[model samples]
Target: MMISRLSAIATAPMRNGLSSASMTSAYAELHCHSNYSFLEGASHPDELVARARDLEMPALAITDRNGFYGAVKFFGAAQRAGIQPIVGTELTIDDGTTPPKDRVDYDRWGERLLLLVEDKLGYTSLCRLISMAQMPNAKGVARLPADQLAPLSGHLTALVADPKERLPFYQEIFGRDRVFIELHDHLAPDDRSRNQRLLELAGRYAAPLVITNEVFYATPDRHKLHDVLTAIRHRTTLDEAQRYLHPNAEHYLKSGAELRRVFDRYPRDIV
Candidate 1:
């Protein structure tokens, strides 16, 4: 099973959306995951870098879950591809309570926040934050409490992933200028509502709104494989992984023109 999975990932078709003549090369993908995110991501660091280069993206941020396991590899690949590598992590924050008893409980216990490195200090703080979360228990699941994040909010920029009730928590720590409300449309049933709430929060706090694809793969065709990966992570078969699966194949890397179209309602946010 491992060998076949590796082979499938190695041979996954690279999408040509980046090379399309109609692509505008305007927006940067700020939230993306590589295979370093374990079974949740379908492509490698090089694959994502090459795709971003082909798309003419000025920069791409690799915000893998939890750790910076792939940051060095991604940095090297991005340098070679002539794309700016924005180092970041999708940190899981919990209520600082005991571990969840079951998978369902664990799923409900945390919220994700994306932190991007802006300079040397930002990178160092990121490392510290990740260490704080992972050092306590070696078990793959590492998390930090929401209240503990304020001290490390100096040089890093934070993006509230899927912005819901946690907006105030992040805003208080990172401040208005340093925090952004991330918006995405994956064709999910709740996307519209989520974006609406996100926009409202951004307005209420006078914070900037940024668009991110929450990319896990390089193309739309890879969505099936991505779904398989999701099943593997949850220790379930495809048929029984509906709760963990994405609703559509629209979570792939998108061209600037495509991004613009999807986020046309919020023109300033795309800027």
Candidate 2:
């Protein structure tokens, strides 16, 4: 099984709406956050690539918050692994006109989604957005305005986040097609609520559903390490900071059969 899995990753093909590709085969991961998500995440670029290769993922998207510190490295690793690299960012949107320095308050509007880049032009635009978001040092880390993201629409793929922070603005300018309502389940109460809200918004806005893992580690066993990183970032002790710990550590690269079970409630295959 392991050798066959590695073979799939080594020989996976790219698809751009091609009808020839079978639905049973889907080896891609979209919302993976490397250590570039500041000090909050545990996995490194090379580590992410290695995990993807082990799982036989054909393509992988890197959507770290605030910066693209590992994009070049991820690109090279994916290329070497014979997999496609999709570059993007998980932006923090400030819709209330006030940016929160505290991570908790900013969770709703600030920590949402907006990923774009189409070819080289799209890549350039993503770089610009990241630069703008980080320009204001007082903006409380990885936060961006709606106008800042306006230039990003239509240039790259936009995954509407679970919080729907920027979905209203993206829907206004780029319509529903360019925006995807991303769904994630962390086996947590908050995650489930956020995912349900995102699904409802997708129906209301007529956006496509794109399932994502929002991964930060390779397996559930890394939960303790991830907890340490989160504590380190928050400047709090690991055991003391209970709120930030992920309820379940199933944020790893799940197999096709596993993903099918998780998202079977929805129609069609989701990556």
Candidate 3:
């Protein structure tokens, strides 16, 4: 017999909330830039993992731009904290390796690529990108080029980064299945427009979408100190630099509830 009553719906609204908990699984940040990105950042990976633990995050990914100097340290920290460490590298493929003096292929560094490890092979490929970037190159910033990066794509998941230039070409070559166009919101004024563009690219390529905090510090309060460090890097004053051009004091590791609010329209299963 089927009986519908208001009490029935409210009495067991979630069947013990088991499915809900299983589906949630505690959302994680699979893309974050750490201190290994150089002077632009202030906190170390240990600090980042510790913060994630505090928030009760189940997993975290450290995609330091162009270097693996902190991988072992990051991995150990996350493991100790009982958080799954998703090994990754934010590739400086367009820069650091190519030189402006070359005048031919130097137009790429303006673009950045974020690589996340999906498995063991992906982690190995990520290490190769880091290794190649840090090795001797015509350019001084320790970067790689598309030719070198294209082969490694199979072993790792690539997310074309901020001002990502090769995205258009990537869609044509890799198809939509293997790529992820990310939307990072740390409160840049153009964040909305940038996210729109990245999302559009994801649609064009049939790629999935991922969001990251691009964390430079752990909390909002640490933001100002991070700003000072950027000023130190460029030998410039906070007054001189365009606001948000360097570090805008908005970058901090946020919680999944915060992330969920941003992409509320998309279900967890979709993201």
- By lDDT, the candidates rank as 1, 2, 3
Global local distance difference test of model 2 = 0.64
TM-score of each: 0.84, 0.81, 0.76
Q: Which candidate do you rate higher for TM-score, 1 or 3?
A: 1
Rate residue 34 of model 2 by lDDT: 85
Alpha-carbon lDDT of model 1: 0.73
Model 1 per-residue lDDT tens digits across residues 149-256? 888887777877565667776777887666777777886788877777766666676766566789998888888988998887667899998998898888888877
Model 3 ranges with Cα > 4 A deviation? 1-25, 95-109, 138-140, 162-165, 171-175, 242-248, 263-271
Model 1's number of clashes is: 0
Computed on alpha carbons, the lDDT of every model, listed in order, comes to 0.73, 0.64, 0.61
TM-score of 3: 0.76
Structure candidate 2, residue pairs in collision = 117-156, 118-122
Model 2 poorest 10 in a row by lDDT = 11-20
Tell me the tens digit of each residue's lDDT in model 2 across 1-271. Answer: 0112211333222222111232234646777888877765678888888888877777777878867778889889988987777777787666555554574343334556657455676777777877877787554465677776666655566776554455676777666555666666666667656766665666576666656677887667777888888777666897776787777787876654455566554434222
lDDT of 3 by residue, 20-129 (tens): 32224265666677777666667888889998999887777787767666788988998899987776766766443435554222223346776666667766776787
